[model samples]
Target: MPRTKPGVGKGVLHPGAGVGKFEVRRFHPDPDLAPFVEHLWTVRWDLGDAPPFVQRTLPDPAVHIVFERDRSEIVGVVRGRFERVLVGAGRVFSAKLHPGGLAWLGAEDASRLTNRRVAVDALFAGVDVAAREAAILGAASEEAMAVELQAFLRSVAPRASAEAARA
Candidate 1:
């Protein structure tokens, strides 16, 4: 089900702007990916002729990989609050990795990536960034995007140590 309750610092853009203008949906990860992933989330917006909406949020410990029409990046745990302006119509597909899941991606110190945005190819050597991005953005629905993302993640599943696994 979609996240109805407003998360920390969310859903306050232009208070009482009327419903149905924005939607945030979350989906469970495939069973095999549950160990390293929390879930996938998609944010869709259509502000129509209204002014742009500025959404803000406090950072969490989990790492996130955000995919958009023009770019995709592996966003490490942010150290401070950040804001994004939602203008026009667009959708963002994000994968929220579990706490300590960065280790699975070969990051020994997740803190090092804090406040940093790394290109996907910089981490996943064999991934075809363009193709993957196309598959994700071209998906007809959030569910379809989740399936594509899950498949891609499985194909590049990382190896984590026993200690990391326990963490």
Candidate 2:
């Protein structure tokens, strides 16, 4: 067998056992996924805004993927985007703006997260993707992580009004 690098940032939480207890799938059939995606979109539009990054070629576009782990187990979901900057001739261009997009997929649903290591891994894998993209593009994450958190807060802001009205 060929020698491999150690802890090369494969998102493997565990090393020898091929850590990454979860797997991220493009789109798998799941009864809960629609609702999850709905909750994310309705209560969290930022989460679903990943693909547009690829569409506009925004140098950094958020991408969405349903996460599955344990072969068939449905783990929690997350979003990741990457931004890059092209530095040349004393001028810097924002190649990608938002890496590690907002992640509020199903926090309210404990069935999806907490104790489910696979779910959490999937989410972090999304994070890894963003990070790797930055590394590959020779760009820096800059403040993508911070921006993602802020977006999450903004997304939930609408819920407050709805809750107040109900009361």
Model number with the top lDDT: 1
Cα lDDT over the full model 1? 0.73
User: For model 1, how does the per-residue alpha-carbon lDDT over 42-72 read when each residue is reduced to its tens digit?
Assistant: 8889998889877766777778878887678
Task: Candidate 2: list runs displaced more than 4 Å.
Answer: 1-112, 118-140, 156-167
Q: Once model 1 is optimally superposed onto the true structure by TM-score, how far is the C-alpha of residue 11 displaced, in angstroms?
A: 9.8
Give the alpha carbon lDDT tens digit for every residue of 11-127 in model 2: 223334322221111111122222222111100012222222111111112223221111212222222322222121111111111122223332234333322324323533334
List per-prediction Cα lDDT, in the order shown.
Answer: 0.73, 0.25
Model 2, poorest ten-residue lDDT window? 89-98
TM-score of 1: 0.80
